[model samples]
Target chain A: MRDGEPLVRWAWIGDHVDELAHYTGVHLRLGLLPVLLGLLISIPLGILCHRWRWAYPPTLTAANILYSIPSLALFMIFVRYTGLTERTVMIPLTLYTLSVLIPNVVDGLAAVPDPVRQAATAMGFSTVRRVVQVELPIAVPVVVAGVRVAAVSSISLVAVGQLIGQGGLGYYITRGLQLDFPTPIITATVLIMLLALVTDALLVLAQRLLTPWARGKGAAA
Target chain B: MNGFLNQLSLVGDWLTSSQQWHGPDGIPHRLLEHLTYSGLSLLFAALIGLSLGLLVGHTGRGAFAVASVANLARAVPTFGLVVLVVTLAGLSTAPVLVALTALAVPPILINTFEGIRGVDPDARDAARGMGMTGWEVLLKAEVPMALPLILLGLRVAAIQVVATATVAAYPGLGGLGRFIVDGLARNDYELVIGGSAVVVLLALVVQAVFTALRRVVVSPGLRAPASGP
Candidate 1:
């Protein structure tokens, strides 16, 4: 707006480097941990559903209903029980991940071909070993795609936690709006987008590494 | 135990008060503001997104490009965009409309595109064989067939916009979210919870209305398979 003051001021970030780092750390945790927790819960639950046909339909329906709940309502409702602590934020964030992840986990397991299961069985693989060694590995790409969506969505939702005073980059957003400053708002938005892209790329890398068979054998010159 | 009871009573009192329903500060007014913001944003988003999506789907070109942009847009936080717009444009309804519109666009666009793309090729061929023009085939044949998924997209977009538009109150604007933002600042947990209850109720009602409408609008033959979880 001024001669030297751009919408996003690099100098302001330089001046508040320590606070920026802290906020960035908070943002990363708020974004990443919930999705990780969801994945942890989903893998076993998804496997059980895959093993037992009866569980899949009900579980899928429940997840969809849960997904429909507004994130703000979910975040705020927990305040009564959890107080203003980080758990209030983490619990809903973690639970929300289940709605998106469970469906994806089930879809991933479903993507596994029937012949692959029979092949593993014929090879004398036990149920647990076959699932771990064969089905789960083949399911990684589909599951990872879901993970990417969950991760990105969680990151966006985490910003909403600022209303409760727990948001990381969200602090800058609220603070900026309150002060009517353009710099922090612009900077945080850019950083959050970059964070999403980085997280997506990392997940893609994880998918590639986990499923080496899916990759082309070293390309030649 | 006592604190929870007090909160409940507080919320009860707030909801029961005739004063809360009377002025611009009233729940009714705030609800009106919230719906107006969400509704207008949805309309604008649907107009732009549906048209582009229809063109992309019917032409079968730029599908990859649209998908890439939609996926990228998914990562952009609504709060960040709202704040950025407010700072640039100053505090007004503009920020809320712009931010919620951004939120509503991708799903509608993606769904409309997919709905059109997913129309049975045989049906498209049959329409062509019947000597229909491209416009006639698209309007009569494809659009009708794709209506269910397109409606599904609109339902998703509308619910999301309604929920998120509450944040408009955070920037000193009036919406149901005003209760939460103001209450939190003043340590009025009851007001916060009361506001959230209304938001949750609104969300569920919107979902139910859409679900019911889907049953009415979608051909009964299409309903069975389109019942996506």
Candidate 2:
């Protein structure tokens, strides 16, 4: 909108750079915070479920159903109950991540090779120590992959949060599409892609470091 | 006048329809249309993505580069791509089709690339020994071995796209997302719930289709080279 601003280009990116920066941080924080919380709670929950067969189905089912909930619909539900804002976004997203990641954590922990668990049990290792040392290590790769998936899903879905008055990179996207201004919309689209790529790269780095023994290629494992 | 009354179901039509329990937006025909919109976008994405992916997966250096770039492409947000496509193609079907196909492409590309790459070198050598050319070996050997994994990738991509096509309503193409978006605008709870039911069903149907398709291509013995997803 300013004089000397280039039209038909992402030049608006510079003018709105601060708004974009402010919102991008908000977006990442909102996206990653729930994942961290999900990881913390689910790791123990997964182990407890693994240790107790009775706890398996319900814990797993709850999250699986949540995973199946469409983001747009779920976000609308949050909007109605919570009113529109990042808070609304955060709540549904946190719930959603738990559904996917918790189950993965549980399964990953359960999949710790029987021989390794047997050896630990035969060595008279304490249940807690055995879990913290052996099972947790083996499960980290799968759990991280789940976390990566959650992170990616949240960042993209959070764009919906823009409609609720949250000023994330999604701000430009929502406005741009509605206002017929390609500048903001395309800029926002490219920015989200860059954000996704960077986040994915970070996950890849984390995965490579966490699972040195995993021979499977790429960030997939 | 008599025919009009007959077509109106003697004024009792409302009682049997889902409108009372599920709301006005929950009518079966409307739900089917929503499914059709989402389903078609996914179908387009799969057909386009798998074709382009297979091409890149089996070809030379440029193909490899395209496949690698697709990894980053998958990371690109679907909502963002919608915005981009809307900017480039406007609010009609083109943007949505382009966006959904872009969303589907990366997984198909990566899976097919990896699947082909993962083909046994010894198998290629065996094919060549049998007087097969490079393309011959690729069709007869590489595709079959890699088909299962590639299909898995395509399956996952299909599932993701089914959910994502709902995002297209933001750019003006209504699918199940229409109910959610329009309902949100009007605070129509029934519409929201009814709309979500359609999305859930769409996801399930896509799941079922992929599961049945997987049964066809998954066996190790089914690794026929010319068989493409």
Which regions of candidate 2 deviate over 4 angstroms? A1-11, A45-68, A85-87, A95-124, A204-221, B1-36, B52-67, B118-148, B212-217, B220-229
Tell me model 1's lDDT, rounded to 2 decimals.
0.81
Worst 10 residues of 2 chain B by lDDT: B220-229
lDDT of each: 0.81, 0.69
Question: What digit string (tens of lDDT, one per residue) describes model 1 on residues B1-229?
Answer: 8866866787788789788788887899998998899889999999989999999999999999989888888788887887677677766897668889988999899989999999999999999999999999999899988989898789878867876787767776678888888888898877888887777778777777877888788777676432232
Q: DockQ of every model listed?
A: 0.52, 0.31
Residue B155 of model 1 has an lDDT of 81
Give the backbone clash total of model 1: 0
Model 1 segments more than 4 A misplaced: A1-5, A51-54, A217-221, B1-13, B120-123, B224-229
Best by TM-score: 1
Q: What's the distance in Å from true for residue A90, model 2?
A: 3.0
